[model samples]
Target chain A: MSGYFKRKEKWHKKYLQKDATLPMEIKVEEVSPQMSVIIPQGEIDMGSSGELRDVLHKTTKNKVQTIIVSLEDAGHIDSSGIATLIEALKKVEAYSGELRVVINTKKIFNVFKIANLDMVFKIYESTQDAKNA
Target chain B: MQKTLNESVYIQLSSNPKMATFLRNNVHKSCSMVGFDEEQTDMIVLAVDEAFTNIIRHGYKMDFTQRIDIRLKIHENKYFKIILQDNAPIIDKNCIKARCLDEIRPGGLGVHFLYTIMDYVEYTTINERNALIMTKHLPKKSRTKRLSSVNQQLLQTLLDIGRYVHQILDLDTLLNVIVNEVKNLIQCESVSVLLEDRETKELFFHTVLDENKEVANKLRGLRFDSNKGFAGKAFASGEPLLVRDVEHNPEHYNKIDEDTGAKTSSLLYSPLKVQKRVIGLLGVKNKISGSFSEQDVEAVTAIASTVALSIDNAYAHETLQQTIPDLSETNRIRKEIESARLMHQATLPQALPSIPQLDISAVCQPATEVGGDYYDFIRLNENNHAFAVGDVSGHGLEAGMMVSMARSCLYTQVNFSNSISDVMTAMNRMVCGSIDKNLMMTFLFAVFNTQTKVMAFANAGHPYPCYYQAKSDTWQLIKDGEFPLGIHEEFQYSTHRIQFDKGDFVVLYSDGILEASDENKEHYGLERLLKLLGSKKWMNAQEIQLAMLRDVRNFCESLFHDDLTILVIHFL
Candidate 1:
């Protein structure tokens, strides 16, 4: 990795741990203009939502049109996380951009229905669909 | 109107049609005996037949094992009151609502009918007996105005049969849903509901003849062999049963026929189970002496399912009230453990920030609900160190509680005392006085004079500390304490003084640390721990502490049991 990438990785790792041990962290890569994916690799409760929101804000602010919030390694999601995703979706909608999600069914479907927002989105079966779109 | 007059009546019936007519006439006689009109007479008759049929078919099953007890009275307000009591089983309401009876065929028609006919329906199980309390108004002026054609017919039934789907729950309100719906749906003289027992396995008439209530005494809690009565058999087999005549059908329980003194021409029975467990039975008798339609079953079943669920719900609500205290106690205990864990964590320094020039680190873990170990480091003179480590007797909350007490007592006087032995003596004495005969604390305290490189310490009943010398490359366990903390009134604590140079490490740990276990239940023995300590090349206290923890963690792979605490201090 380049010095900038290494520094960012170290920053990401350093800011993530509790006490001094960084909790399992997600990998975020600003690989291209139209793509930015956040892959959480550990439990994602309300504690994780703040960091997720920050990452989404940074990506969208950079004019990333298609954002993939991937949970390939993420363990869980609380009410706040689902709410943050909805808010982030709304943000993307304002820009006429696409926001894609890759998560377990139980984690997202229940929240979507409980909040009555299941019908508002163009949901795909997998994250690959969002990336391809 | 309020009625509290104590009048109790108990009756048993035979299913002969003559007895059924007698019951019909007697109900009017009973109503007029209290000066009630035909409208009131109809309510009593309808409710009585409903109750009697439920008991005979569902409760007694053609055998006279239990009796029906009816408590009736004309209160001071001239209102007719009745409480039908039985000893059947009780069903939980939540479990009842959990079922889907809206399917093409339902298993709950009788309960729906009962709910439709009575002005008020109540089922209560006290001790072992079950009771049904149904009430109705005698005055026509009390009836609702602007009734629909279906409700008008049902109202007329109330005059002769007591009540139907429209005012079924109490014969006073709106079963408009079941009434209007059933008019276009099923055929019957009146619908009734029998409450089922989930625990004891008996069914009883909870809502009878739409308004008047009859309860079974010996009838409650009667068990069935799955295929006993038309209703009991249906409940056991998980199937719907249709009988054209109670007299002709061998499956029909004649006790209902014999008890009511009326031979029911036809009977239909099904189980009102919620969440797979049978809660009660729902059945319709003498279906207008005609061939019962699938839609008739469908419509009655629809109403029955909802009514069964309602009865189940009411039953559960009563039970939940009884069990709330137990549930809350469990929740309260759980919350206490959670808060105690937080308090224990808050007591520890979040970061144990680095102390300049001197290497220092500490840890505290326990074996159970709470921990008893404690270690505190207070800065003395710029070149001097003040520290104390204590282990309270026993384990869990009691010991943990004493740990806090010792900490508080030491903290209050350390600011005023400079002598480590004096502080230790004071602490020992305080703990001895505060704790009862069963509780106590063993403590070790020391003050290190950096300039002189001298360490002065006092020990109570606790174990010795082990020191590692870099010069000799050897480890020595030092025993410098007396017996445990609370035994004597003025227990004399011993003091020791030693001079130390750079690169020497002192390790203090609760016994739990050396005795920690892995998944295989093997302990991280003291010998292995000593060997691990002997192998570490690091002289810094931080490095030694971290290495020790790493070794312990490695030994306790997937199953780390017990609390392990270790503290290491090194002279720089």
Candidate 2:
């Protein structure tokens, strides 16, 4: 059973494609030396989640004290998209940095809720709301 | 279960990232057209997106110019099916497993979403294209129209064959797959792919398949000119030809049927072209049913392109693998020969012996390759001096080492004994004992007594030395034919005596001088050497030596193929 799971893991790694960039538009805005905001538009699924991860990884590596991800314009978010946020959240917490996400759509929020990561991350109504908090 | 209206739509898109939005819109419209709500449509659209992105990222490796085809079909307003196809190497579909979503990772989620949203998802390959077929169980709705499904089994068959061809890199296996697929598709009695030898341009039977095993076995070894048969006509014209009756056709070449003992009733020949150049011919013989048709010609022509591309790729791969090793081996041998050349140069006579009665001059010019040629002058006592000119057979490191070994043995043996025969016998025994029979040495050993004016010399398969007596004004070659050194161990070597007078000359040389060939392949033989020496007899030893070398150079304009060494002695 362990060997079967290992093979299953290999299959996932093979089929789950990753690229240097994604198709959607992603904007990174700097608030200060230790704070930043990432705005991703359109669908954040398998095809575009890689770009989201790239932005989040850069912000975490820069040792930002507070990183805000705004998903107001995103129409859809799949499991891979949710996993990208979870991965970034883990990196930010490791350095005692704060990661806050602002969701305006119920569909994209439901994806995070379905993955049970709504409680794992700091969710707000908007980027301004999260920055004020 | 009642069947209702069947609707199908086909869409083609380039493998570009921006095309994702266009594809999503079409898939979403496709779901609603089948009477699905917005929420369920989004789930179905996302699944199709994931599958398409996987094809672009992994299958095409993100080449945006490649084409992708999608077929959306709704069956009875219940079963919605999507088939996506792309021309890529066939990957094993069985190994595709959705990740266990328990592990929170950035990847492995696209496949999970695919498996969760779709009712039944499957992966397959057709031709050289990877295909993903996903089916979703639609919510039941009221509809009462009956329709028939489109027949595309032929397309599937071509896809299967395309997959087989591109997946195999080995030329032999690819040719076999081609023959088997052609035979199965056309239902022919025999199939063969005769590839032209790129250098010879002769068509040889690379793969042959026949129901009659004996005929197939005979045809496997058969080859002929590519311009002789109906197949040749197709190859020459770069077109497909279908002959319904072989006996009635004037272009039919019956040599293959006669040689293989198989009757030729009909033949269909298609030229396999890659990049507009015909590489080979694909021929099918005697259709199993009635006769060949235009449809059969079209089918064969279609697959020939795929076959030609695969064969060319395989040939390129095989040539690359072969060339790398050959280059490295040549480099290795070249370095060894260079080192051997340095070793050969060190073992030559550094300075000629200086005596009051004799003027000795010697020159040993090495060739490009390491040639095992050596000459030495050793003073035995106050009045007598021993000298030798020898050549080891063959070239490179082995021959170089043999010359070095013989030099050491000659030096040791000449010191112990003054007899020319004793030094010759000892040198022969040492060569025979140390190395194998393939390598041997031709040596001429001579001891000159300056006081008595007598030259005693013995030959071991070496060319006889040229002797010019000033008194007789005539040249005589000291002739003796004996086995070269490293042959017979106990063979007795006899010494020949020559009385020298004032102004006498004797030339000791290796066979390279006598056998040197010009551009016309004519050897600079003994007659040329004698004439040259007679003309330069008035000059001193060194002058005559240079004159002889110049004459040989004039005879052969190119570089000498072997090592040339000459030792000259003039009685002063």
Candidate 3:
């Protein structure tokens, strides 16, 4: 009778907690010598974690070893996003690659410390700087 | 309401030590009505006498012709609001910081007494009127456990967290201080830090929370090496892991929990990062009995970041002073102040909402590292827009962060589809969970629907903002709201709604506007605000903001000690 998921008496999926669309997307392109990357924004939680993982995995299809995960635009994150990064790092390391972070706003910088992932990543001051590095 | 509400009586006492008795009686009577006890009565009297003595000796220099206005009519809840409207010995609200009780002496204790005893204080000079409004209510002694305000619990938690560390600003101390604050704030059974070793490429135990035990026991010498368990993952990935049901979670490590005899059920951890580089893992394990909320994560993150930045800033300043060898203490304090300022800026206004029908501008000018005043704009929905401005009962960083807590509650409520009244109620209820019972805040919140031209608002013991008429060019004061948050939930905020035709301006301000003082010790009162609005010198929000600030600056020669917040809204 409904378009989305409907529940039976035995199985109750709290309707209020249903998954929704994400506001962040990891868009990478091997466009010419000049590069532009669109990293995730908002909370990098489990909801957007898979999409990010898949995007990062696919973005490496081209043998571009130097990639950037620009986080200056990102406001928050959970462990799932960190996991996705770890997975991406494994793939990048397989080809001797380098993943850099762009922190436009230092607000996101401390978030890395709170998550304990600051040591695991190579972060730069800005996207342009990350690209240069 | 037009001719009566703005009425205030000023009485200046020059060299009247005995007037302190009368001051005590009058204030005590007003305070008793607002619920002060005999002890509180004595404290208020002492504070007033010291103030009166200081004024008589220093301010007027025995200038009897210059009167200090003592207006005692108790409205806004039978609370005694002592308005020392004087042209002598003006008190600077900026100097109101928490002095170490160890520095307790008699000579300069007037401000300290006023701060420690009274609940609220504001100093301002409008059109040459030096006015100080000191507001306070006696703490409910009989019903300690029965009542709680969110602000009280939050401040209490901060204070508790602060208790573990001798001083909050002392970062060169050790990780023991950080762990102690975390343990106190989280009410955790135990706290341990896991830091990544650069040379060894391994994680080792750094500190522990044996706060009540002893200093030597603080670090416990515990180590959980690489890939051992949750702490290791936390160390490896540099992320906080909360094992709510630690016994059930596959990744939880119970060694530390077993060692402490702490049943590992819930946890909250934050990573210590410096410029996006994780230094280590700091966590509170086994939260008393419940699961931690997202707010817990955010709060831990905030505290951790503040610690990291302070440590880094101190380290840099120390290095600069040594290597460059020309840096001054002022430069060091300035850097400290700047980083503190950055922390405030980073926490505020991530994005100014581009609401479809709203053009909003808001600003926060703190007198110091943190101020007691705050005003925020939060959109509840498409049509229902909410904004709140408030001042905590005291001054300083503690009070400022409490204001942040109130703001966060409002934001969380706004995010969860909460209405204005619901938001206020939730905020009040939530304050009791973390703040101390001693602190309270005066707040004003409102919602407006542009299409219907209806504005709904609630005021929690805050100064009334003036609602303006573009056609008549007259200001109408909306002075009907309830007590400040953390006072009592039994007091409900009365939501008043009115439909505007169009082009009406609404001006909201802190008590600082009515109380800004000049060198002559004269204050800028509400009549002046009405005059400014009436003269048509300032038409819209921008003009009014600039003009009012200009007038206050001219009145006091523009040097402000207490914070000033002025918000204006116009309906098109």
Summing lDDT over every window of 10 consecutive residues in candidate 1 chain A, give the lowest-scoring window.
A14-23
Off-target runs (Cα >4 Å) in candidate 2 are A1-133, B1-333
Backbone clash pairs for candidate 2 read B126-B159, B127-B159, B127-B160, B127-B162, B127-B163, B128-B162, B128-B163
Give the DockQ of candidate 2.
Answer: 0.11
Better candidate number, 1 or 2, judged by TM-score: 1
Could you tell me the TM-score of chain B in model 1? 0.41
- Against the reference, the lDDT scores of all candidates come to 0.54, 0.72, 0.57
Name model 3 segments beyond 4 Å from true: A1-133, B1-338, B350-352
Highest-TM-score candidate: 1
TM-scores, all candidates, are: 0.38, 0.35, 0.36
**Model 2 iRMSD vs. native:** 20.5
Question: Tens digits of per-residue lDDT for model 3 on A26-129?
Answer: 55655343343647755454335567777777766554668788776565443345557766766767788777777765445544443445676788888778
* B1-572: candidate 2 lDDT, tens digit per residue: 11112245555555665456556755775575556677778888878887888878778886554667777876655688899988877888766777765666566666777887789988986445688889987666624432212113223334434433323333454566568667867889999987775555577776898989689979984878878878778889999988888987776788888888999998888888754467787889999999998878867776676566455444433333333332456655655564467567667654456676897877776665777788888888899888888898877777888888898898889878757778888988888887467788999888889899888888888888888889989888878658798888898899888889998888888878888887578899999887776664454575566556656755663223335888889997
